[model samples]
Target: MENILNYIEINELISTSGQPSVEQFKQIADNDFEVVINLALHNASNAIENEDKIVTDLNMAYFHIPVDFENPKASDVKLFLNTLQALGSNKVWVHCALNYRVSAFMYIYHKYVLKTPFDDIDISLFEQWSPDVTWQEIIKISYDEIKNA
Candidate 1:
């Protein structure tokens, strides 16, 4: 497991992170990841230019959802899950600057979509730090909607 900044492999199916350099993409490729899902905006400080090309060049799919850190929406959560479902069993690496956005969304996915036991995923989700008030609310709202749907 090459060092991807803030990298955490949740399972064989998923990983989360901050931006990794092109060289690090090789490590992801080496690990047999088939998709790179970036939640960071294109203009995000560490966002790499031509990322789609870079990831695809490495023979991996690239899906950019561009989550707004200050204003995460429930729709973004839906889209993230949809993409993962569409990927079937393809290995995925989901990342955002510092892994904040990635972590929040992953928490929802793990708990709601995967039906994972709370205790199984909480420490991994919050190990670095818990989501702030706004993000926590976003997660709650998203989960509530899904539960009620």
Candidate 2:
């Protein structure tokens, strides 16, 4: 059994952070109907080998978010949204070295994209699991860059 960073359910996506075993992925796939987003810093050999096959078989898209979950780049978020929309994928799986990136991204998506209130967020879960690093500043900076772009 490999170590698990985080496992969360967001909408229809099953976002997993960290190195999950083939068995774990299989279990997730079993229950997942839409797509699986892998936000891992590094993927297991089995995952890499079977990714396309599994995605095709399950009718899911595998998105790889390029950023250190703890210290994510704004470009990464932009790319993530772009890729998802480009693929017409509504369901996503966002994972990373830990669930930090996935959680932060969700927060941003809900607050910015979905226009959800900050106070409505489950801050405790994010605060508990996320790195102490301040991503809000980074997100703001990134948002500005995207707006400029």
Candidate 3:
């Protein structure tokens, strides 16, 4: 747990991190995480081969929503929000290659679904790395869609 790459504990219900090794996934399972949601592509840097099987074998539900780093979409954010809502209070561990995607998605989720004010939401993780134009646009679009709804 201590060595999980870029691991950020976002309250009791969720944790976000970079791609985790198989052993880290074991640690996540041992720590009582009920679900593993992967946003990284299968071929992403540091990604575990057969990660779905690895997580499922550890008795944790696994979800993969591959997000294109260069062109994040509002649909992706929507799906992430829907999945998180459906999962309810499950202890979910969400990760992407370097946590960039997860942070952005989590930011949108908090701002919209949780009805948290943007300034009140913690974006430290999202701010760890600067998002380029594509990511910025999607973040704006995602929030706008939710706000307009």
Summarize candidate 3's per-residue lDDT along 12-59 as a digit string, tens digits.
899999998988999999999999999998888688889999999999
Each candidate's number of clashing pairs is 0, 3, 0
lDDT of 2 at 92: 53
TM-score of each: 0.90, 0.69, 0.91
Error of 2 at 2 (Å): 16
Q: What lDDT does each candidate get?
A: 0.85, 0.57, 0.86
Model 2, residue 97: distance off in Å is: 2.5
Candidate 1, 62-98: lDDT as tens digits: 9999989988878888888888879989999999888
User: By TM-score, how accurate is candidate 1?
Assistant: 0.90
Residue 95 CA displacement from its true place in model 3, Å: 0.3
User: What lDDT tens digits, residue by residue, belong to model 2 across residues 72-106?
Assistant: 67777777666655645455555555566667767
